[model samples]
Target: MVNRVATYPYTTSMIAENMRLQVKYSEINTQISSGLKSQNYKGISSDTQYLLSVESAVDRLEAYNTNTNIVLANVNTMYEALGQIEDMANSMLTAVTAALGGGQVPTAVTANQASNALDETQSVLNMKIGNRYVFAGTNIDTPPVDLTDPAWVPQTSPSVVNSSYYQGNSTITSVQSSESHVINYGVLASDPAFEQLFRAYNLVLNNSGSITELTEASGLIRSAIDGIANVRSNLSINAKSMEDQIYQNEQDKVYLKELTSNIKETDIPSASVQITEIQTQMEAAYSSSVRILNLNLHDYL
Candidate 1:
C-alpha cells in the first residue's frame, strides 16, 4: 500500500477554492436581484458626497419650481382682474364720452355706473389666493383696496391722484426663479396704474353735474386704460419667464435623476452575465471538491 502524504493538502486547497467561489456566487446573485451597486452610501463610498450634492441641487430646484408656480398663479390672477378692471374703465369712459358729446353734465346713470365700477374694482383688487390677498404686497392678509372706507377721501385733480384707497404696503414680493435668478414680480394695489383707475372712477361719481369734470374724467380713464395695459404687459412677461423656468426645472430634474441612477443603480444585464459566470465557476468548484473528497489510494492502484 502506498501512503498519499499530499492528499490532505489537495483537499484543503479545494475546500478553500470552493469557499471563495460560494462567496462570489452569493454576492453576484444578491447584486443581480437587488439591482443596486450598494444599498447605502457606504456601499458606494467614493461617490457619497457627489451624490449628496446632486440630490441637494435637485431639492433646491424643486423648491424654486414650487415657489414659481405660486408666483405665476398670483400673477395670472392679477392679470385677469386687471382685464376686468380695464373693461370697467372702458364702460365708464363710454358713459363719460356720451355725456361730453351731448353737451350735458353726467347724470345719475353715469354716477351709478361709476359707483358700481368703484365697488367692483375694490373687490377685484382685494382678491385673495389661499387666504393671502394678491394685491396686498407684504400685507398679504389685509384687503388692498377699500373705496367704501369713509377715511378714503376722493382726490379732485388727476395730477394729485394717488392710491388713497390702498391699505397695503409698498413692499414688493420677489421669487427665486432658479439658482442664479430672482424675480421681483409683485404688483400692489397702490400701483399708479390702479391709482389712475380709481381717480377716473371717483371723478365721475363726485362730479356728475359738471361737464368739464366729466371731460377730464374721460381723458383720465383713457390714461388709466393705457397704464393698466402696460401693467398687464409686464405681468405677462413675468408669467412667461416663470413658465420657462418651470420647464427648465423639469428637464433638470430628469437629468439629476439620471445622474442618481448612474451613481447607485446596477446594470442589470451586466450583473446577470457576472452571476452566470460565477454560477459556472461555483459548479466547477463543487465538482472539483467532490472529486478531491472521493480520492482514494486504492482507486489509483
Candidate 2:
C-alpha cells in the first residue's frame, strides 16, 4: 500500500508568523480568562488604571476622615468642660444672691467657695480628650497650660485661687471641618466670658464674701456664664454638622468602592469561559504545527 504525499513547505518565516499569530490569540484569550489585561508588571495598562488610582486615594480620604473625627470628638470635650464651668458659676451666683445672716450663716466670709470655683476654671483650661489637649490652641501634644510639665507652669498650682490672674491667652483657635472648612471648636480660658467669670471669683475671694462685692461680681460672672453657654451651643451645632458630613462621606466611599470594583475587579465566570476558548485555539494551532513539521524529503520519493 502506498501512502499519498501532501504538498507542505514549513519555512522559518511561515513558522515564525504562525507562531506569532497563535501566541497573540492565546494572550487575548488568557486576558479574558484571568479577567485582567496584564497579569505581570509588563501588561499593566487598561481601564483599570483609574480604578487603581481611586483605590489608592481611599487612603488619603480615610486619613481626612480621621482628622475630621478627631475635631468632632474634641468638640465634645469642650462641651463637657463648659458645663463644669457653668456649674461653678451658677453655684457662686447662688451663694451671692442668698441673704446671709449671723444666725443662719457664718458671718465671716470664707474664700473657700470662691477657691473651689477657681479650681473649676483650671479644669476648663486643662480639658483633654484621650491624651490630647482639646483647648491647647495649636499645641496638640503639649498641654496649653502645663501644670505639671514644668515648662509652661513651674510647679503651677492646679487651683487658680486668685481669679485676678488670667489663666490662658485670649486668642481663639478653630478646627477644620470634614468639608475642609474652619469652624469654631472651643473657647479658650482667657476668652472674654472667662474673664468676666474670673472677676466674680476675684470679688468673692478678695472680699471674703462681702455681700457688696459678691453682688457686683455676681452680675458679671452670671453674664459671662451665659456667654460661655452660647459658645458651647454653637460648638455643638458645628459638631453635629461635621458628623453628618462624615456619614455622607462614608456612603460616598462605599459608592466609589463599588465603582472601582466594577471597573477593575475580575469576574471568575467570564475568565473561565475565556480560558477554555483560548485553550481550544491553542490546541488546534499545535496540531497544525505538528502536521507541517512532520513533512520530510521522504514524502516526495
Best by lDDT: 1
Q: What is the C-alpha lDDT of each candidate?
A: 0.84, 0.65
| Runs with alpha carbons beyond 4 Å of true place in candidate 1 | 1-14, 103-106, 148-151, 157-159, 297-301
lDDT of 2 by residue, 1-301 (tens): 1224433233555567667767766776666666665575445556656767777666556766787898777788788778888888888777666523333444343467776776777666776677766665555565454333222221111223332343344446665544455666656555667767766666666665466666667677778878988878988898887787777667767887887666654565766676676667767767876776676667799
Q: Which residue ranges in model 2 land beyond 4 Å of their true spot?
A: 1-42, 46-53, 99-103, 107-110, 128-133, 139-171, 177-179, 290-301
Decoy 1 TM-score against native: 0.90
Specify the poorest-scoring 10-residue window by lDDT in model 1: 1-10
RMSD of each: 2.8, 6.5
Give one digit per residue, the lDDT tens place, for model 1 in 1-301. Answer: 2226756676677778888888877776777778888878998899999999999999999999999998898889889988999998898888888877775644888889889998998898889888989788889989999876776676564436656678889998889989998887888889887887787778878887677677778888899899989989989998999999899999999999999999988888988888888888888888877766666767868
